[model samples]
Target chain A: MVSITSSRLVRGREARRAAPALERPGVAWAIPGLVFFILFAIVPMAGVVYLSLTRWDGLSTPQFTGLHNWWRFFSDGQILQSTLVTAVLLVGNILVQAPISILLGVWSAGYQRNRAVLSTIFFFPLLLSTAATAVMWRQLLDPNFGIPPKLADLLGGNTDLLGGQKGAIACLIVVTSWQFIPFHTLIYQGAARAIPLTLYQAAAIDGAGRVRQFFHITLPQLRNSIITSTTFMVVGGLTAFDIVLLLTNGGPGTDTSILPFAMYQTAFRTYDYGYASVIASFLLLLATGASLLLVKISGYDKMTSTMEGL
Target chain B: MRRRRNVVAGFAAFAWLLVIGVPLYALVNTAIQPESKYTDGGPVSIPSAVTLDNFRTVIHSGFLHYVWNTVLVAALTVAIVLLLGVPISYAVVRGRGWMTRGVFRLFLLGLAVPSQAVIIPLFLLINRLGLYDSLWGIALPTAAFALPVSVLVLSGGMRDISASLYEAMALDGARPARILVNLVIPLSRSSIATTCVFTALQAWNGFLFPLIMTQSNDTKLVPLGLYNFVSQYGGNVPALLAAVLMSAVPILIVYLFARRALVMGLMGAGGK
Candidate 1:
């Protein structure tokens, strides 16, 4: 009986060892997701690429136009202006949004007892849809009854933040930063909290003050999180559409129009499907290239390993 | 020095309150007061009379239909995301081979391709399939765009599960599917919840897709509905604010309940 049991056990181990190689169940498990992705994402992307080479109104058959759309995109001043606007927003986000969020994050981290309440308050805007945010700000910036105008009234100046060209762009940047700051703040805060308390204690014993400790320990430690957040901001700025669209409609005569907004208008209003695809493709390339460069610069592989460990 | 630090901290807290509190104050303050109060005292006036009239107006104008549509779309998108995201993440984590690696890479590529980039073709494809102006049309693409992050988070969650558990399960003659159901699903519950909330938020907040894909008023979601409300009721600031407040309430409630999962999930995605 003992011999028979041992033989059975050995056979079971052998079967189990062979099971993985023969099972191939991963393919079955992964197919539904693969199908959905291909149908919606991959295939549509391919269609964009194809349509970029052809001029097609929605009503008519697409005619092969070769590089006409690309050439047009190069010469088009509006498109170039939109690109410039997007670039400005990206730079503004990096310069203005990042520092403020980092400071808030650092401050929030220092005040551990009130962290939750502070985070909730700061992050509230993130939960509001872009549409709601845009409307809220539109109301707040109304030249007559809006808060900014009211404040401007108090300050004795006439400022229509969303009406003029430069003002509109600036307002868009401020509102976008306002909505997104909470997200980046949380990232920075998480990074801040992860730093060893021992490091701070050691610094204190060494006679380092708060400012010195922050600059020395906290800033260096939060480098990866900063890079990550900046990457998101850049990407987000490049693709900014909903808030811009709802708030200004890329308007006061195209002052606030970004690339995506221009692409959207070209496709839907002008009905230039092919040219829109070209713009879309261009934006895609820019986003992908910029993100990869940012990730490469920031040592994304190291970040991923650390994240996985978390 | 400690006293000064307290002063600075108190100032920071107050600054935050103004930065965040003022807008919420405006939204709610405008929402509760009557239209006459808004017009008479402007936005800054204290409300002498609180009224539900604005909400009544919004509801009477078929606001609930739009709300129902958004809820349905969000729910379906979440369901599809979890159904696909969970299993595929498991496969990517547990399966070994170039196919699994390649599949994971493919999903990651989805992250780079923003919906804005592919929306033109998505629009055409939806029309071609005769799904234009349908809620499913909007939900389908939203789920696809949401999948990359969902899979990333779930796979991260699954990887956190110990190898010993898998080995133990396998030693008991359990199949991969059985292991997934019994072990992986229960273990990755937090990640799953996170994905659900994240995807639902995306669906609820989706504007561009619904804007381009669906046209008729009957199919309008909240974002689009809010936009139309602004255009239609451009003069009725109180009524418009009421609609905005109502549209935002459900998601705000969700965030309140699932604040930890939401923040953790966002951080996980950001870290990645």
Candidate 2:
């Protein structure tokens, strides 16, 4: 009996060892991709870290600076301001947009009959490039010929929505929120739909109204989804580019200069690659830290289980 | 009570439609309005004159190259993503080992690290590879960045297949490689298609990578191309709007056709 069991185990191990290379006709195609990612992604990332310490001007040899760039980032008020701007956008995005999206998502999901149409319309903005959305909304907020001015005119005031800091920032907030809400709504709707109908029936039997049911049942069930959407929103808001680049370009006195744009301006426009890399490193650290926190807080294990089931 | 509930639901649906529809109406209306009446008229009023002049000018503004470039980039990126992501996903899903776990963690780290985080490094790397101003640079990075989501979706789909299928194949003397092609690929077709659509849209309309990576007109995608129009022809609202419309039409068509699949993929993977 011992000899037989040992032979079976050896056969099992042999089968396992042979499984991967045994007969995948399509496996050969993946080799090119493996090489591509290795060379382009993995290798270049190393070069970035290495070159960040050295000064290179796109042509000449790089000279090592040894944390001088990081020191400059601290002393340089502009880079600091850019970080602050990105943070402000993050805070504003979560504070202003998330709640409305949740409400709309819940409200829209409750009425499933029209969901296909309404959801499509809501997602329409997403189809447009950020450049196009920027242009459309920019035209709509044109201090002279735009929609906001027209509304302001009717309200008996002359306000330039894209001119001042408050107006410009507000317009950006509104446009970004408008552009992004459909994404969160889709997430929220999917989660809301996934909640077993029996939960709502039980809540109804308990005499809970729609609003109460939402708070007690829907919100709790959607906790994972809320965390997921929040993670995306925070990351996206922190690294916003296209909308700001087209509409404001951090204009009217450098008001909207977020970290990504600032990094770009520093490196390419000004040719200060070392300083730009310093800023880039900090941004990467912050984004990575936030993502880690998101995964921790959201119970990634549970989400993964749910995903696997689906 | 049933009748009352229907009325309420109807009213709510109408409200939803109003909020969504008006903005769309405004986008189309403003885009079609003639240039002469652009700023002088009421924002809510009907266009004084509708013309294809904007479309004509946009087509004439050398934006056709951008449209073609975007298509090429989005297509090639999707192809590369599938080529790489499918096997890795299959391996990770099927194999139970530290190596698989390690590979997965690498992708998860990638998920946490958005392309924006590595834009600076990516730029330097592209410059070094002599692909800085070329289309391949954007295609490669976009595919790399898209790998995490693609793997997530594809692996999720793959995991749903029963162990018995693999067992049966193994008993029949089929190798993992053969099973992947004959069984896995055929079964996961929808998932793969869905992944392709979402990744394509993401690549086509992506802003940041193309913004920093490519500087010249030869490799500019539609998004960058539209930005250039604003710089060259800001006051020409009709031309700019035309360019915007042209860039949006193709993606809009895809969205209309594959709306459910694309949204399902996003909600299943990244949207979640």
lDDT of each: 0.84, 0.75
How close to the true structure is residue B157 of candidate 2, measured as C-alpha lDDT? 78
Worst-scoring 10-residue span by lDDT in model 2 chain A: A20-29
Q: Taking the candidates in order, what DockQ does each have?
A: 0.56, 0.47
Which docking band does candidate 2 fall into? acceptable
Where does candidate 2 stray beyond 4 Å? A1-35, A153-158, A299-310, B1-19, B265-268
Model 1 agreement with the true structure over B113-139: per-residue lDDT tens digits: 789999998998888889999999999
Q: Against the true structure, whose DockQ is highest?
A: 1
On residues A1-310, what C-alpha lDDT tens digit does candidate 2 reach at each position? 9966886686578778765443333334344545666665566556556667877676677789887776777898887777777887788888877886787677667655565667667777777777888987776777677676657757467557667776777778888887888878888887777888899888888888777988999899988888888988887876787788889888767888888888778777888777777777777777778788776786543324333545
Question: Per-model i-RMS in Å?
Answer: 2.6, 3.5
Model 2 per-residue lDDT tens digits across residues B134-174: 88889989998888778777877787777778878867766
